[model samples]
Target: MTSLSPAPLISLTWTDHVTGTEGYLVVDRLVRGVSSGGLRMREGCSLAEVAGLARGMSMKEALHFDADNPGARYIPLGGAKGGIDCDPRAPGAYGVLVRFLRAMRPYVEHVWTTGEDLGLSQDLVDRAATEAGLVSTVQAAYPLLDDETGARRRLAEAFAVTVDGIGLDELVGGCGVAESALAAMDRAGVPHGGARVSLQGFGTMGGATARFLSRAGLTVVAVADVEGTIGNPAGLDVEALLAARDAHGTVDRGALRHGDRELPADAWLAADAEVLVPAAVSYAVNTVNQAAIKARWVVEAANMPVLPEAESLLAGRGVTVLPDVVVNSGTNAWWWWTLFGDIGPDAEEAFAHTRRSMRALTDRVLERAAADGCTPRTAAHALVADRLPVMAERFGWYR
Candidate 1:
């Protein structure tokens, strides 16, 4: 069922002259001479981790391919990812980022189209890209686009659009995650009004997911950030805490009410809830900590958040894990949809597309899981296995 190679198509490591920090780029695949992924900056980011993320992106893109649908303008591209081994909060981190981008400029200009990932923001990446003398982070895609100017304009407008003070770009991905959770709950005969959820990380992805799930009538019982976990049995005021977040996505502890309890950093793993979302970092849930989870479902809102061994353990315990390739793919798909004219700059249209696509995909994965008696991750990989050959037949294996 494993379709992708263990080794990536191309791998490069760069050492920054300013900080001597390492950066990595792994192109998992390429379609039409272009590949898409995000640039993540974090401490201890290894080439192996970047390679895993790159492969995950390949699956994420392949999962969305629909050739028979005439209205589907978004043709999923191949996967690539970049990472830097430095803390974004550390001194001279920006310098390292600029230098890293400068070194990766050739790929960005030719083959790789990237945006922000963990420990970095799109705005920060855009600024760094500008300083690196690059036209845009996604400029490589311009050549493949039919009307690059119009697509660029539409994307910019979409990025500028906001709903209730949250950017449209940020909400679409979370909307997909929330819908996947809802679809699973519906399949399991659980009511949204009664489901209690706990999540780690309050950044753009996690915060937006909390907003949508809260609006959908789910009680967000706990949320964790760098400092610690904030929990309330009665459900914390999601809006108030959202308003109190800093640029780095950490919620201001001073904003907590009397009912909100600041717990230990790992408290979210053991919180009394029906659903758990590890939206923070890679390998957040390992075999040892998997025993602490009592939730019926663990939805990965972060890439590679759950290790394979941990996932196997959770599956043995009757806990279903919705894989990251399926759960967190909305934002990437949304970008392509808008750029390729499948969707527009309007928030409502974007949300509708994301919901429809994510719900259908989730249902398909879950149904296959049930029929095959396998994990959702296995089912998802099987689905990808069935499609990659077709895409390769049409587009060819090598770009």
Candidate 2:
């Protein structure tokens, strides 16, 4: 029996308040010659928390690549994550971020490729380039980010204000959330064509999810942004709302109509819907509001949207909460499919492959979870954990 625990290859910590922050760079595994993950900055972030996130990235990449295949021509990259405990909006935050990045350049240059996570944006990337003189390397690394393009471009454009020549491509990440949500709905015997769905958080993840799910014919009855939650029980115009969402995914209150009601924070959770998507941040479904959650399924579009303890309670209540490790892996799968897979001249064809691969991956994970009688999160982790020995043997990690 294989136990699912985060066995990180290395966990490095630094406490340099002189640089105005401290963080951890946890490299969970190395598949071939490389590893990849995100870099986030938020107050109270810890080494252990980043280590856990790195493990999730490891599971995400392994499952997306069909690690169990053993002989597949996978990308051979592992999972790594870095983050600092600080506010990104503070007066000296930019200086602190640049100093931190300069200090970590040796580790990030090759061993661990990182991207934006949580509070840190492309501004950090842009400014870090000017301050640390690593714009060329960052330019190459950022385009590899398949999902969340809008956010990245915004960050790169933030570079235009003070710097020159750095560019970013457009990307988004919620297709996997929609696909996995529908896959889970399919397994749970729910009708997606007319399923009532509500999303909390209207950022790139939630916005893209609303777009895809709505296009698939699901009724998005409610959506919440930073300002507040707004809904129309019949359905909300997802595309219009997506276009209307601001830089930070704040939807305009004035744009909502058709008997729309501005509900309280808990309204999205309690919406009379079949699915609830928490695409904002971790611990969205905690003990206090977990009880009010009426949806039959909870799809985590954001990383760790549902905490472990709250998840147990939801399971007891019969709410099937799909884990981010499986549900929100569209971003990783897109990276594997686009930047990594064999490409032809057709852009649409490549995108089609991405969609098919994502759907298949989600379906397989859901199928395994059902068969194993474990949560999808646990099942996905098991799938990755089981392949570690083979990955080591193939990639020569231990040698």
Candidate 3:
């Protein structure tokens, strides 16, 4: 008799058109016991991309569960992602957003709990959940806002500890790009002391990156959001920019005095800078824009921020591109450790282990890439693939 194989997790897609724009909800992998993911809103988001992200989340969780902590005894939580292909910048965007959320209400009630993602805010999520009456007992059991803030703080703290343990300084808050850029610069020997930095996207990641880079002695020459680009060759004050930034991450126009110009959204890519970090959406650095990038190094803090073709193009131009999987895995791994607590009684020690592991992984990948003249992305994949089988065998996943 043949042994029964486990059922493959289900992926669901739903689409709706409202206010003359289309929206999609893609559920990637649903662990039968617990499930979670986020919603992404942008003009070009597709079901395929959302589905792929969900699957990645699943793999992320699986790896965390299996290797990070062995005795957590926690069942798998399925992963899901939703995307809406509506420009959040347009008029009536909020209305379409509400409709999109309403359409996915049933899923939110039963098997999924969605949080903020690209172009989506926590306020919007709370509004949608409240409107749909899908707020869970867990959410209702505590002081709503306090619970969210507390959890986020704890997660952020854990992330900081993990990074510090790895021998890297704590990430200067901004987006993932700031952290990734720091890592890339450290590896590439780019001097931060007098480097001029330009950033596209001022959201949590971008804004944080600017502030951190500035504090670290890098001169932030330009910053751009969906609204426009602001520049000052003498270096913009990150603190002033942060104060002027609105909730959507756009800097207030009235607060600038310098070489600021109202340029196209993509203009930030061409700005003169020693380092350019894209902490915005995926595919921002595609074929068309690849030729325009002026930075000596491009560090992607967002998932798949550069298309493969763009990466090839940049590589040919002698640009060093730091892959997201390695750069941001530190944050992902920390979250998993927090959720499962598999590191034994000493959370500090466990976090230290995570940091050491992350730094070691980065060093190994960089060393291999240099030795073989390969891209960091390729080296990362090769490293992971080689180690995974051994990990599986040790975990008893195979006899």
Candidate 4:
């Protein structure tokens, strides 16, 4: 892990009187006078977390755009994230969301274009935008229909294209997690069907990755949700677990029939698996449990999933880790397509392009790491950061 670096460019906080809650907006960097990100509202969300996420988002932009294609017009927006603390299910959540958006009108209009995250849903974003007089047409929350299946059905009726399945693959970041993980396994000489995987945080990101990895023939030996971890020496049934997941992406422990043993909350770390994915939250694989992780690869499917010291420890122990910026980038690619693609007739081409872009970049990072004798995280940091000085020089933004 590297030493600490420069702090964020701006950090703003305010209290929304309507919700009686605090809101934080952290701008990690400003590229070309713009920074765009989501407005998440998970319980216990904090300013530091928002800043860290903004930093990650910034790195994602750095890694995605470069000299060859440049794509300067739309490729890299500055990195920022906004968040609030409040129960999304509260009866007055809409009022709180409206007030929160209104309070941040200046930032939203001039600094960042924010979307939904965590507890912030599509309906809430739309309602808030209308009430706050901000344009609601562009806010993004996946499967916006609450019922993805229904949305697909409606799309099929309106458009002549084929829309298949519930289409969680529409969730770009989750798809990226599986793609990067599989690519990492392939680099390690683990064949497509040969790797065994374990995952923590069986929510949207984790669950989507599990479905993808399992479909691609990986053995998911252990998975843990908020309550506890479950394991089986042989692979667990990904289909069953997905079917059992709650609306919030949790799988009830009571629904398990195949997992041979139910372990403590942290036992997922000790699973006899080849790949470990911490998809739940930050500080999950830290000093306390870092020593116990047995996986050959730790793919961070969540932003800021590993602390610096733990990442260093894992590297010292010869466990390779594909950083979150690489493994958790599918959604970023998806968003680019969503905003820019001409889905009328070239939709298939658009998706194909997204997948290829995600894979090519991930492969580039992995290869560079192999040659440089550093962790993927380190290699990715250098590879992406090297571009900034040039960008700053040309853009005249950094002093």
Q: What residue runs in model 3 are displaced by over 4 Å at the alpha carbon?
A: 1-9, 17-21, 30-36, 55-79, 89-113, 136-176, 259-264, 328-361, 383-399
lDDT of 1 by residue, 262-367 (tens): 9999999999999899988999999999999999999999999999999999999999999999999999999999999898899999999999999999999999
Which model, 1 or 3, shows the larger lDDT?
Answer: 1
Model 3 clashing residue pairs (backbone): 31-78, 34-77, 173-208, 174-205, 174-208, 174-209, 175-205
Candidate 3, overall lDDT?
A: 0.62
Candidate 3, residues 191-277: lDDT per residue as tens digits?
778888888878766776777678678998878887877777788877787778776788888888766566777777887887887
TM-score of 3: 0.73
List the lowest-lDDT window of 10 residues for candidate 2. 162-171
Q: List runs of model 4 lying over 4 Å from the truth.
A: 1-5, 70-74, 87-94, 137-170, 259-261, 342-351, 393-399
Superposition TM-score, candidate 4 onto the true structure: 0.84
Query: Candidate 2 lDDT, tens digit per residue, 155-175?
Result: 433223311111111123666
TM-score of each: 0.98, 0.84, 0.73, 0.84
The weakest ten consecutive residues by lDDT in model 3 span 164-173
Candidate 2: regions farther than 4 A off: 1-7, 15-19, 67-74, 122-127, 135-172, 344-347
Q: What does candidate 4's lDDT look like per residue over 57-152, in tens digits?
A: 778877776567644223455678888877676777667778888877776766676665666544457578778987542332221224444433
Q: Among all windows of ten consecutive residues in candidate 1, which has the lowest summed lDDT?
A: 390-399
The full ranking of all candidates by lDDT, starting with the best, is: 1, 4, 2, 3
